[model samples]
Target: MTTALRTDRYELTMLEAALRSGRAGRDCVFEVFGRRLPGGRRYGVLAGTGRVLDAITAFRFGQAELDWLADERVVDDATLAYLADYRFTGQVEGYREGEVYMPGSPLLTVRGTFAEAVLLETVVLSVLNYDSAVATAAARMVSAAEGHPIAEMGSRRTGEHAAVAAARAAYIAGFSATSNLEAGRTWGIPTMGTAAHAFTLLHDSEEEAFRAQVAALGVGTTLLVDTYDVRQGVETAVRVAGPQLGGVRLDSGDLPTLVRETRAQLDALGATGTRITVTSDLDEHAIAALRGTPVDAFGVGTSVVTGAGAPASGFVYKLVARRDGTGADGGAWKPVAKNSVGKRSVGGAKRAERLLRDGVAVAERVVVDDDGDGIPERDAADAARAEGLTARPLTATLMRDGEPDPQWLGPEGVRAARAHCAAAVGELPAAALRLSPGDPALPLVTA
Candidate 1:
C-alpha cells in the first residue's frame, strides 16, 4: 500500500509554500535525533530503519490518495500534481539498525531537494519513534531476564499494524519469539503461543482442557496452569500431560513465591523438567526482581509493547542544513537550528562514531559537517588515535538515490540487527545494564 498519506497536512502545505516561493528545489539536509533519552534511559536502541526504507519506497500518491486529498481540499491542484509524480530520489545515511544511541546522536540523515525531503518528516518519525521505543524497552527486558528468553505477546494490547511492528522491534532487541502470527509471516520471527485461560474455561473442567491441549499440541506444549487453583492446576497439568509436560504458565499471582512453590511441586510430582513461564504485565524491573526465582522464561505483553511507560522515543526530524542560496545550483550549505529553550537542536549535517577503549564503549562523537561532506571511517580512526581511543563508525548508507540497501530490508536484516544489538550492548559498561534511574551510559561529544 502507498504510504504517502501517512503524513501530516502541514508538510504538504509547507511544500506548496516552498514551491510557490521557488525554493522547493533547493538542496536540503534533514536529520533525526533525540534531545534526551526517555525516562532516564541509559541508551536507546535504533529500530525501524528497514520499515522506514520500505515506507519511503512505497511513498506514492496514487489516484485514490490524490482523489481523497482533492476532496478534502488539502492542497491546491499544483501541489496535487507535484504529489502525483513525487519520488524521493534522496541519499539516506544513519546509525545502523540495532545500534544504541544517546542524546544528540544523529540517528538518521536525509539529503534531497527541499520539496522531496520535507514530505517525509511524519512517516519517518512515526516509524522510528514507536519502533525505537519498543526496542529500547525490549533490550532492557532482555537484560533483566539474565539470559532467559522473552516472547512478545502484546498483539491484543496495541493497534493491529503496530502489533506486528512491535513484535519485529522486540525480536530485533533479542526477544526469542512472538505470539503475533502476522509478525512471524512478515518478519520471519519465531511464532509461539499455547492456550489462554479461556481455553481452560472452554472445557467442562481444567483436566478436560489440559487433556485436549496435550492431545492436540502434545506434551511439549506449555499449559496455562493458574485458571482455577495454582496448586491443583499444576497437579492436573502434570497428571494429564504426564511428567513430560514442557512448561506451565502462571498468568497471575505473586510470581516470586508462586514460581518457587510451583517448581517444588513439579519436582515432587516427578515433573522436574517442567519449566515455569511467567506472564502478567511484566516490565524490565519486574523481571529483574524475579532474578532469584525459578521462572524459566517471560511472556511480555503490555509493558514491552507500550515501552514500559515511555511510549514514544521523543525523536525529532528537523532540517539541519540547506543550500545557502535559492538557486538550483545554490551556494555552500548553511547550518540551521532551533534555539528554543529546552528544545534546542544542533545545526549542520552530522556523522557519528563510537569511541571505544579496551573493547568498551565510552562516548559518542558527533561530527558536524557544514559542507555536507560526510566523514570517512579512516578520518574518524585517525582522530580517535590522537586521543588514545579507537573509533567505531556508527553511520551507514541506508539508502542511495531512493533505493534501499538489500541487506537492511528483510528478515535477514532483523536477524542481523539482533546480533548487532547483542554485541553493541555487550560493549557498554556493566553499569549500562542497570535498571535504576541514572545518566546515559555513554556521554555525547560534539566536534
Candidate 2:
C-alpha cells in the first residue's frame, strides 16, 4: 500500500502553487525538530527512524492515489501528472534511532526538490511523534526498574496497529519483552505472556485453572494468582505446579506489601525459586516505588503505550532553507524561517554533536551551515586549547535518493537501535536518571 495519500490537503495545495509558480523543482531543506521536550524530560530518545525510512520508501503514488486526487480535483492536470509519478528522491540525515536528543535538536533533515519533499511532512511527523513519545515513556520505566525486566503489555489499550509499534518502541528503550505477538514477528522483539485473571475465572475452580495451565503449558509457565484471594491463589498455584512453578503474577492490591508477603510465603512453602511478577497500572513512578521489593518483573499496559500522560512528542516539520529561484541565484541556498507571533522558527541547515567531558555527555552543540567538520573529540580538560570538549556526531545518513540505508531497515536495525539506546542513556549524568522534575540533563549550545 502506498502512503502517498497520508498527507495534509494543504500540502498538495502548496505543491500546486509551487508548480504553478514554476519553482516546484527548486531544491529545499526541510527539518524536523522539537522546540522543547514535553514535561521537561531530561532527554528524548529517538525512535521510529527506521519506520520513517520505511514510510518514505512506500510513499509512492500509484493509480489509486492519482485517481482519487483526480476525482477530488485537488489540483490541476499538471499537478495530477506530478502526483502520478511522485516519489521522494531525497537525502535524509538525522539522529540515529535510540540516540538521545534535547530541545532544538534537529531530529531529521530532508533535502530534495520542493515538490518531492513537501508532501512527506505529515506522515513523517506522525511516525516520529507517536513512536518517540512511547519510547521516551518506556525508557523512563526501564530506568525506574533499576535492572528488573519489563514487558510491554499495552496492546489492548491502544489501536491494533499502534500496539505493535508501541511494543517495538518499548523494546528499543530497554524493555525486555512485549505481550504483542505482531511486534515479535515483525521486529524480532521477545514476546511473553501469562494467563490473565479471566483465564483463572473461566475454569470451575482456581485449582482446576492452575492444574489445567500447568498440565498444558508446563510448570514453567507463569500463573495468575490474584483473581480471588492472592494468598490462597499463590498457595494453590504452588500446590498445583509444585516448587517447580515458573512464576506467580500479582495484579491488584498493595504491590510492595503484597510482593513482600508473597515472596515470604513462597519461600516458606518451598517454592523459593518461583518468580513473582507484578502487573497492575504500572507506570514509571509505580515501577520506581517497587524497586526495593522482591518483584521479578513487570507487565505494563496503558502507561507505556499511551506515553505515560504525554501522548505526543510535539515534533514540528518546517522548511528551514531553500533556493530562492531556479536561475543562477538558485544554486545558492538562502535560509528561510517563520516569524509568527508565538511560534517562531530557526533558519538554516544544521549539524549536531554531543559534547563529552571525562566520558560523560555534558552538552549538545549545533552548528549552523556547517560542512560537518570541526567537532570536538577529546576530554574538555585536555582540549582546553581547542574547542574544549569532545564532540560526538549524532546524525548519520539515513537515506540517499529514495533508498533507505540498509543498516537501519529491519529487525536487525531494531536490535541495533535498542543497543544504541542503552549506551546513550548510560552516558548521561547521574541526575538525568532522577524521576523528579529538573532542567535538561545537558545544555544545548548553538554555534
Candidate 3:
C-alpha cells in the first residue's frame, strides 16, 4: 500500500504554499533526533532505519490517493499533479538499527528538495519513535536477565500490527524469541510458545489437558503450571509428560519464591532437567530482581512492548539546513534552527562520531557546518586526537537517489543489527547497565 496518505493535512498545505511561493524545489536537509532520553535512560537504540527506507520507497500518491485528495480539495491542480508523480530522490544517512544513541544525537538525516523531504516527516518519526522505544526497553531487560533467554510474548498487549513491529524490535535488541507468528514469518525471528493458562483450563482435567498437549506437541512441550496450585500443576506436568518434560511456565505468585520451590519440586520428581520459565508482567527491574533464581528463562509481556514506562521515544524532525532558490541564487546551505523556549533544536548539516580511548567509547563528537555528506573534516579528528581519543563514524548512507542501499534489508539485516547491539552494549563502561536514574553514559561534544 502507498504510504502517501498517512500524513497530516498541514503537510500538504505547507507543500502547496511552498509550491506557490516557488520554494518547493529548494535544496533542504531535515534531521531526526531526541532532545533527551526518556526516563533518564543511559542510551537509546536506533531501530526502524530499514523500515523507514522501505516506507520512503513505497511513499507514492497512486491514482487512488490522488483521487481522494482531489475529491477532498486538499490541494490545487498543480499540487495534485506534483503529488501524482512524486519520488524521494534523496540522500539519507543514519545510525544503523541496534546502535546506541544519546541525547542530541542526530539519529537520521534526509537531504532532498524541500517538497520531497518535508513530506516524509510524520511517517519517518512514527516508525523510528515506536520501534526504538521498544528496542531500548527490551535491550535493558536483556541486560538485566544476565544471559537468560527472553521471549517476546506481548502481542496481545498492544495493537495487532504494532505487536509485530514490537516483536521485531525486541528481537533486534537481544530477545531470544517472540510469540508473534507474523513477526516470525516476516522477520524470521524464532517463534515460541505452545499454550497459555486457557489451554490447561479448557479441558475437564489438568491431566487430560497436559496429556493431550504432550501427545500432540511431543513430551518436550512447555506446560503452563500455575493455573491452579503450582506445586500440584508441576507434579501433574512431569507425570503426564514424563521426567523429560521440556519446560513449565509460572504465570503468577512471587516469581523468586515460586521458582525456588518449583525448581526443588521438579528436581525431587526426577525432572531436574525440565526448565522453569516465568512471566508475570516482567520488566527490566523485575528481571534484575530474579538474578540467581532457579528460573531458566523469561516470557515477558506488556512492559517490553509498551516500552516499560516510556512509550514513545519523543523524537522530533526539524529542518536543519537549506539552500536558497535551488542553487540559482548561489546561496550556500545555511544552517537553521528553532529557539523556542523549552524546545530548542540544533542547526546545521552535522556528522557524528564516537570517541574511543583504549577500545572503550568515551564521548560522542558532533561536527557542524561540514559538507552535506556525513563525513568529519580533518580538524574534527585532529581535535579528538589531541584529546587522546580515536573517532568512529556513526552514520552510514542507507539510501541514495530513491533506492535502498541493500545492506539494511531482510533477515540478514536483523541478524546483523542484533549482533551490533550486543557489541555496542558490551563496549559501554560498566556503569552503562546501572538501573538507577542518572545522566547519559557518554557526554556529547560539539565542534
Candidates' RMSD to native? 1.2, 2.4, 1.3
Decide which is better by lDDT, 2 or 3.
Answer: 3
lDDT of each: 0.94, 0.89, 0.90
Residue 28 C-alpha lDDT in model 3: 87
What ranges in model 3 sit over 4 Å off?
327-330, 370-373, 379-383
For model 2, name the residue pairs that clash: 376-391
Clashes of each: 0, 1, 0
lDDT of 1 by residue, 326-405 (tens): 66568888899999999999888899999999999999999888787665334889889899999999999999999999
Model 2 earns a TM-score of 0.96
The alpha-carbon lDDT assigned to residue 302 of candidate 1 equals 95
Please give, for residues 1-447, the per-residue lDDT of candidate 2 as tens digits. 788888899999999999998988888889999988888788889899999999999998888778888899988899988888887888999999999999889899999889999999999999999999999999999999999999999999999989999999999999999988999999999999868878888899999999999999999999999899999999999999999899999989999999999999999999999999999999999999998899999999999999999889999999888886765546667888899986798888887888887779998877677322223343333332275567788878999988899999889999999999999999899999887877889998876
Give the candidate number with the greatest TM-score.
Answer: 1
Off by over 4 Å in 1: 326-328, 376-378
Which residues of candidate 2, in runs, are more than 4 Å off? 327-329, 370-388
lDDT of 3 by residue, 1-447 (tens): 888887888889999999999998988889999999999889888888878888999999999899999999999999999999899998998888899999999899999999999999999998999999999999999999999999999999999989999999999999999999999998899999898778888999999999999999998899999888999999999999989999999998999999999999999999999999999999999999999998899989899999998889999999998885575553676888999999999888887888888878899888876445455566666777898888778878889998988879878888889999998888788788898788999999898
Worst 10 residues of 1 by lDDT: 370-379
